[model samples]
Target: MAEAGWYPDPAGGEGYRYWDGDRWSAQTQLRPGGTSAAPGAGHDPSTPIVVKGSSDDDEDEPRAGLWSQVKGPVVIIAIVLVTIIALIWALMQLGVLGNRGPGPSNPTEFCPAVTDGNYSVDPHPRDGRVYGGELSYPQLGAPWSAPTVDGRVPFGRDVQTQTITIEQNYRPGQNWVASVLVGELIDGDGFQSPEAGMDMVARCIVGAFYGDSPVQREDVTRRPMVVDGREAFMLEMHLSFDVRGLQAKGETAIIIIVNTSGSKNSIYYASIPDNAQQYLPTARDLVNQLRVGG
Candidate 1:
């Protein structure tokens, strides 16, 4: 054979052995710079030897290289997973993904001492058809005078002229009282517009108050106001009437005309005495709270 080939020792020892073409021989040597000697005598028995092709150092080098190659990707994947979990937890805590607590609210403060419980929903005692749900009136113990009825039957003369009347202290022998009158009347077939219907209501009211006395109409002012989210016409006028043979200065009358609750085109009339000026703001606020449907 060409020279004695280097081969692993056949005795399962850790060293290169000089092998003739067919077999391992006793001529052996250590790798790199170690001395060469007979196979059984070359190295001390306790000395470590490295096999030519299969060493612990060779296996450890490949494993360390593999870890270095994949280290960045593995760390990136772990960070992304942690961030997603944190975001989901934060959203759940903020109630964006679940039911949490109430946000905020507002309270009605019309009068200084008024609250929602101070008002009561009162339907008409006699006529069940007429409904004024939740009439926001002053409580019985309040400072202002409680409402009452005038001498006249609150309901008007015809089926077309049903009325609901409220007044402030019409005592046993009082000369005058502040009043509020809400009336529903039929719309005339010939009355083509709201202006015409308003004119007719004005004529009727003036006739009732004037009653053959020499009447003086002063400052007949008309303006637009809102009632229950609908547009209403407010007509304010001052008149002097004959009472018990003496010319008495009547309270300034403010009449608000709007569409009726039940009728398609009929008029709903609301009148307030200007003498109740102190209570006007409170009254307007209370009317704003009126909801039509029961």
Candidate 2:
């Protein structure tokens, strides 16, 4: 029959327990410094000590308090998990974990997507000399004119020699002619060796140049040889296509990556279309006759 107030614990603990008007509650508090009599034993009715849970106790409050106690740790654990995942991704990017061999992380590192502003068709030298006289090739006759140079520098490097290209003039989707590209051998970002660089450049050319057409590549050949007294890597393939607007059915393409002086490299690309299959020998001769200067 005690009024709702804090009283000495009936469980004989050194603390006060909350007693509702009807029953005892599980709530407890530190014992106050004072002599107190049990409730309903002539205790001062006006000086009743109130503790928490003396009023209508909410059952959900205990669960909510328990959640509050553990909420910080749960949030901390979630943050730690996110940090670990991000660190793993960074390591993978740095080639520390889940390494994928020596290749460019991005496909565009060597052969970027061709945009109108990234390339040009300029008049080349008529003397067959190109790249500031560092290279030379046989000049084609009449229909071929002088090979027009298409200068393309990768996205980052500002050097004009990053890629030096020259090709015989021909109407796209109508005729095909042989072309050559000389790329500087970059050391980092997956260009560790001549062979690796050759592979990346070859694949980039196929995707960037013929991606819009339904092209099929076959008869791929890769080898190591010496060109102009320097070590070189060569890649050759036949590409066949049946595009609606294109007149030629296929072409034989070649890529030659040669190491030059000062650790530089030259890339020679040649494509002779099926329509010009008779010129295949001429193309091979051109490859065989490549000359590279310092």
Candidate 3:
């Protein structure tokens, strides 16, 4: 029999287990590199001595260390953390999370404060000459009367169908009208180019004129062009709407924004209702004849 001390685990796990004279103890420790006989080999014991089997080459072989045991779990944890961080960054970019700053200011908000000396309130001429500031266009005869300040917004003067009347609660498309606005672009307009500014202004007009009404716009197109040798942009669209107490179902709208002298811009807006579709050709002719200067 062999007297026992610490020996290779009888269970074949990678360590040493404590052994008493009668049986193996529960205590354990790291295995030293080789397999050896039990301590005090010639003593008497109740149980047969057990020896672990190993080759001569295994004497110098390294055991699996702590890093090897935890490597897989560490790599898995790192991958999960990276995925979570990437997801958060994507959400922030899409404005689903994190702070998103305010959008562009509506250009029409600056119109009321514009006080240019070149602007005047005058009745437009009937003999093909209609003037608003430095801008002018030919008049559409009969039902399309002279331009007036009665239904004018701070942004411009307008000409309307003769059948329509201006009232205290007048909406823009309520009576189909063509407006010509000429003024200097103010500081807070929130746009640096005529194209971008005109697009914003067109959206504002839709909101103001057809408040709370379901409006569908179709055949919308825009292009850059030269008007009286000045840079200009034109946006045209067909608006169909269903509003309470309004007889017209839809209208064709055209908006032209021209960058004139210095910081000034000229705008021409026209809307012809579906009920009076016959006048659309006349409106087009008027736009074709626009003149920017003397």
Candidates in order, TM-scores: namely: 0.38, 0.50, 0.51
Compare candidates 1 and 2 on TM-score and give the better one: 2
In candidate 1, stretches whose alpha carbon ends up further than 4 angstroms from where it belongs are 1-175, 190-193, 245-247, 261-291
**What's the TM for model 1?**
0.38
Q: What digit string (tens of lDDT, one per residue) describes model 1 on residues 177-291?
A: 4344333333444334434455445545555544454444453676765556554555666655444533234545555555434332223333344444564454444334433
lDDT digits (tens) for residues 122-167 of candidate 2: 3345555444123445555544445444444332111122111222
Q: Indicate the residue-level lDDT of 137 in model 3.
A: 71
Off by over 4 Å in 3: 1-128, 150-154, 157-188
lDDT scores of the candidates, listed in order: 0.44, 0.58, 0.58
RMSD of each: 22.1, 12.6, 10.8
Candidate 3 residue-wise lDDT, 163-242, digit = tens: 23322123455444433333233323634566868755676666656656766665467798888888888888888876
Instruction: For model 3, name the residue pairs that clash.
Output: none
Model 3 clashing-pair count: 0
